[model samples]
Target chain A: MNKYILSKKLYRNELATFYSFLIGFLIALAVGSLILFIQEKNPFDVFSLMLKLSIGSVNSLSNSLNKAIPLILAGLGISIINSVKLWNIGAEGQIFMGAIALNFVYINTSINNSQIYILLLLVSGFLGGAFCIFFPAITKVLFGVNEIITTLLTNYIVFGLTIYLINGAWKDPASLNFPAAAYVSESVYLPTVLGKLSSGFLICILFTLIAYYIKDKSVFGYEMRIAGGSELTAIYAGISAKQKAFFAMLIGGGFAGLAGAIELLSQTHRVSTGISQGFGYTAIIVAAITGMRPIGIFLVGCLFGALTIGGSVIQTIGVSSYIAEIIQATTLFGALVAQFFFSYEILKKDEND
Target chain B: MIDVQLMGLLNATLQAATLLFIAALGELITEKSGILNLGVEGMISVGAVSGFITAINTESLFLAVIVGVLSASAFSSIHAFVTVVLKQDQTVSGLILTILGLSLSSLIGKPYVGKKLEVKLESLIDIAEPSNIFQVLLSQNLIFYIAILLMIFTAYILKKTMFGRRIEAIGEDLKSADSMGLKIAKTQFIATCVGGAFAGLSGVYLTLSYVPYWTDGMTSGRGWIALALVIFGGWKPYRTAFGALLFGFLEALGPRLQTYGFEMSPYIVKITPYIITILVLVFLTIIKNGNTGAPKNIGIPFFRENR
Candidate 1:
């Protein structure tokens, strides 16, 4: 057998990503099977059960679709910043702030018009997420601070704020010592399109389409690509790297916030500590596995949503729901490894010689 | 009464600081070698659960710590291989590692939750009567002393040793380091493992000595805090230790103040560390004119063929 060497590819190969994801996804399933085997369960049985529960029925599919809404929005948000090579790990916190901001508007407003109130809530949610990321963005642009740590740190701060509000100012009088905000007024609740599926699905799809257009076909996206590629290159090309980074990060934050808002208005209907369920962090995986493409994010988001639903379904059979998270993370790792092959091709010893 | 309370406060501060310092020092080492491992949180969780389970079964703190450190080190190799060999994005890989670690821990540790461990690492210098503040400070577990020693050792290695120089050179400029015949991938992989080992040790300290029990999300956000402390300390060993202690004091102050009948909200106290971290980042940037002592090639993947 001849030795093989990794040779760098001169041109981008789109099919590489597709193959990588496919192989990565299979690897993830293998790993998940191994975990199930270790737990004394039939991997085949569990896998089939998960598949059936996630998309086996129309109702289950709708539930999975509903779950995908937040993931898609947050994934899109994270993807925008990823384009600029910026990490927005604080989407978790941005979601909290968005929920809080939407609740704040609901608690104070007396608006009875459904359309106007829903619009107001959605905008507030977007603004809330942008506001959450404002400090990290400014510091990164102005002071050269690491956005990753700053953004992650901000999540904890926002969690604290959420707890403070839930326990003090926004605490529902009827909650009776349990810490949570009052239910959002029905006037602003997102209309349900099907069983458990809300109109937020359309909003998320619309947002993804818009994001795709801007990121792929617009000058701003072109400039962001340049800015993210290299600061020197961006400067040479007359693009303000700092400004682009700041705006991209803000937009990312807004998307995360909007995710939180939609989840609140459509699903939970009240601000609680468990509103996010780590959706923000999971979105990072969704965004990564999809190669930060808007359309791919939507598809991957639904896949993960199915996995999440499958996680809960498996809980009925003595399996922990954390299986979903484990599988998701493993998939991302597998994809990262697979992506390496995309950038470099394997050459035989004779070929190299 | 005040004197006793003050001593207790100092003790709690030191305990908290030890946990943060160990993990932050680990991160500092990894970052020093030009690899940013955001998976510190995940590593700590894996270590904590594995160590806790081992302590419960084996009833030996030594074995527990070794198991914790080894497992975490092994887990970190995935990161090393992906980032160093495969040349993937360190940030995304590290984040995924965190997710994987945490979920893996929770999945495996599900059986061991709330089970108490009989073996505990007790204070080495158990003074029956501590006469002064120094004695009070000295009355900490062997791991606490080990943390201090590790800090000193880290400082020495970074500032004085050839290996340290290699790491610094690779982190600062990989191309030049490669020209000088340094082993970039090997040094980085080892450094990342060492970092993982330190994080594991931190987790063992938490389960065996500090809280001495297993709980879901027990490490909470301490891993993230330790990451911030690395930056807040400006990536220097001693300064990082100092920053850890300062944050530790804030952490300890919350419960102590409640006991003292202070009405400050716990939420406010909890957020203080994060807010202060951001402020410190801003302050450090302003004072140093944006030249924070981060490793220049900190998160950039190295691909020799491309270069």
Candidate 2:
């Protein structure tokens, strides 16, 4: 009996990546259209309206950018961890830790100085994220524990703690009994930039560049590539693969933490359970769809930012905001399938042939 | 008085453990076949919503459970195809399946939110005395009794059946299994799909017997916990069932503590399962190989080289 077989291509197909993105995008759009049709709305009209809401006006653009800021930073974080093949799904928890740390510094300190406050917040946020991930990272390195479930479990605990803080200990006396932390001092709020945009956008860009440099060019990056690609090869090269894994997770966590801090300082002045809006989770998709590249993550973050802003926009047309989630998820599935065809081709032949 | 309270806690544990036990046992099958499907959370959600919608429309518990299992299996089939047939990364595929399941379920479930169920599975017996230990033990929804039977049957099959040995062989040494003429892909696919069906049933138990209402994202990470329980239970059916009960007891303890006027925040109590899981991992690591019970090649995609 003879059958068609799948054979892996010898060389990488550069065009495969481009085709994958296109296919994934098309699939996402198709899903969105189907959902819209079910809702009895013209898919094209809603799509155009969503674009307008996300990027049509300065106000909308600013909102979109604000939404994208955390996503970009968090995506970078996910990219860092992905490079080392460490599945740390705890970025959401790290973001909360960062916010908690930033708030701790802001409220506990007597220093009302804006410059010092911002500087301290950023540092504390990074440390907070790094600290939160240290447990899983160390456990993985030393004990061979799987970071995936541990990190995922840690997320619920962090979120639970966040809720407890907002409702009980950290409740803002001035919030009029609302379950939210007190707003940051006026001086500590992020300064405005171009037409309603926060300076946080610029910081995100800066971090993106920094991440690119560290991931693509730095010695640490070289070591990480070796460690991630093959542990034996890295060990033979005299590089400590375990150390690299630990540091990768640490840096990744820090990036997510910083994202949390920026989101709080720039957009939401007070901490609440809804502060994240699942940016940590969306960032994972952004990182994956972009192949975990820094610049690509930024672009994907922008698209997701648009989706986030547009999700609420479509609600006016009676569509559930969950459409964005569906589209995002579908895109990932399509992309993964597309990635399969990149290196292998299936040949069909008669079984008797 | 204390006996009554203890009995209530035990009763709650049975209900909670039954759902977790169903999911954990399914995952055990999937893992034993060397495929790690991490999308249990998403599959459970799909099952919950689908079963709920079915119940709302048909008012038939059996139909709802069937729909729930089928929907979850259909959702998980994507993972099975990608990981088994395509030989893609199991972890990433599992995650994408999860995200897809969640979004798709929420999309379909949008209309059913807050809708009261037309019918739900009823307990097999009614206890005249709420504090009767025997009555409390016996009087539970059909699913709970079914779960116990499933647990025993699964244990028996795994320990005594040729099919179970084949699954174990494929998981432990795929190459040997393939050389031995075992259908590796088919076995793994069937295992993962069956695992998904159990997870789906877990969801049915959650919505119909437990909450008896339709809500978005109702499973709420119980699927993830069940995955961890697969490890805590040493990948054995009986041990896993015991772990489920342990988890169930912890889950029940949280609410019971609240009822008892414990000053601790409910949020802290809610996080106990996760913390316990972490501690369990650490303890396992300290005592032995942390992942000792995991099937070898659990996440590796099998590819036959022409050699």
Across A165-270, the per-residue lDDT of candidate 1 in tens digits comes to 8898888889876789888777778998977688999999999998898788889899999999998999899999999999999999999999999999998899
Residues forming the 10-long window of minimal summed lDDT in candidate 1 chain A: A344-353
Instruction: Give each model's whole-structure lDDT.
Output: 0.89, 0.86
Q: In candidate 2, what are the lDDT values of residues A1-353, reduced to their tens digit?
A: 33677767678787676677779888889978988898888999888989999999999998888899988998899899888888868888988989988998887886767788798988898888888898989988898887898888888888888988987888987766468888888787889898778998999999999999989999999899999999789989999999999999999999999988888888888788766987887887888788888998898898889888999888987878888888887887777788888867777755554
What tens-digit string does per-residue lDDT give for candidate 1 at B1-307?
6777788888889999999999999999999999999999999988888999998999988999999989998999999999999989888899998989988999988999888778899888897555568987778998898999999999999989999999999999999998999999999999999999999999999999889988887888788888888887888999999999998988888776878888888788778878887787678777888877889999888766722
Give per-residue lDDT, candidate 1, residue B229: 85
The backbone clash count of each candidate, in order, is 0, 0
List candidate 2 segments past 4 Å from native.
A174-178, A348-353, B258-262
Worst 10 residues of 2 chain B by lDDT: B283-292
Pairs of colliding residues, candidate 1? none
Angstrom error at residue A347, model 2: 3.4
